[model samples]
Target: MEIKDSVVLVTGANRGIGAEWVHQLRERGAAKIYAGARDPRSVVCPDDRVMPIALDVTARGQVLAAAELANDVQIVVNNAAVSYRQPLIGGDVDRIHAEFETNVFGLVYVTEAFAPVLRANGGGAIVNALSAVSWFSFPGMAGYSATKSAAWNLTDALRLELADQGTLVVALHSGAVTTPMGDNFPIDKIEPTQVVSAALDGLQAGQTEVLADDISRVIKSTLTSDPSRYAAILGG
Candidate 1:
């Protein structure tokens, strides 16, 4: 669906990809953009069309409140995520829980809260910000990778479930970007705006999934290759 004059809700919009989404949507002439963050005051979108909303996606009450506030919203962007640098088997359990809380469960909860809203609004779209690691595991961040993988599957399931409602479910996958979350990584990273731009473009084109960068594209294409070769690339 076209973004022009469309009402959009974006989670974790205080900065990074979410902020970029808000900016890009405004530039595309969105009717209103609800910028959802834990601290609404931190959202710095300059346009009057932007509405900063206090939302903690993991909290059902907060998600419900956001849904009420953004009642006119048709597009929901699930962007909030936490990356705990730990393993799935022997990692810090608290960290793993925190990661799943924000990255996986939070997205699912927020999606559930917004599903009816989208349906009521005449069938809209849901854009989930996933990761390239959803397809390939990285050492020290296996837990995070697993959450993203689960989210990818959730997006698929949601697509099937929401088909009758005509809600377009789009999954966005990308390698590390030049955001606060990727500051510790040394590899070359794409700009957050570039990633968001590509994703929104794909949404406009009615794509079900968006590979936002070269790394993501390469990783996805490699899925058809020998499993052992792909596993070797992840240093398994």
Candidate 2:
């Protein structure tokens, strides 16, 4: 779990949170970072230790190919996701499915593809990029929130399934992040680095879940007791 000298792979590395993950991992002295995006050319980071890879997470073939190519990876960061801001009652079915495909299924494809690689490399770690919405759904982005909710369970399942292999699975959650996905959010947004730093620290600390912001932490604390408390935060 030590970032220093560890070989890692971060999906959606072209921009936003994924881009910051690569930068922070490098700052922490990661030996190498396989920066995966749909187009490797989109990864504009100038770090020599950052190796760009063509990875469209929704594509099973690309996911498997990435595992084969980045065989030395000790940590897999599942950061590739898309949010359509679609709602449940009236949202387009195709967009909702697309969100699930990238957010939930993408994590599945990556974990399935890399579980063996992790075991072979001494039981590494899998860090999934989740959201506070995984705990409670708000309006506007209902479909996106549903995908994260599914991703939360998927992360838990992967953790249990990969435990025998010694892979550490961690779910990192945040509220409004200042990424393209959060630009339209009406709430205050935290910098992507804030979430990335907390996630990495949590991974090193061996935490199964990381609450990266006040909203995420609060939601986690009250989810089982009073799920409706989130209503106040969301202006409900």
RMSD (Å) per prediction: 2.1, 1.4
Error of 2 at 124 (Å): 0.6
* Model 2 lDDT per residue over 1-236, tens place: 79999999999999999999999999999999999999999997676999999999999998999999999999999999998765588779999889989999999999999999999999999999999989787678888888999999999999999999999999999998999988757788899989999999999999999999999988887876365696756766
Candidate that scores best on TM-score? 2
Worst 10 residues of 2 by lDDT: 224-233
True lDDT of residue 174, candidate 1? 91
Q: Write the per-residue lDDT of candidate 1 for residues 117-147, one digit (tens) a residue.
A: 9999999999999998888776678878888
For all candidates in order, the CA lDDT equals 0.88, 0.91
Candidate 1 local Cα displacement, residue 145, angstroms: 0.3
How close is every model to the real structure, measured as TM-score?
0.93, 0.96
TM-score of 1: 0.93
Cα TM-score of candidate 2: 0.96
Off by over 4 Å in 2: 224-228
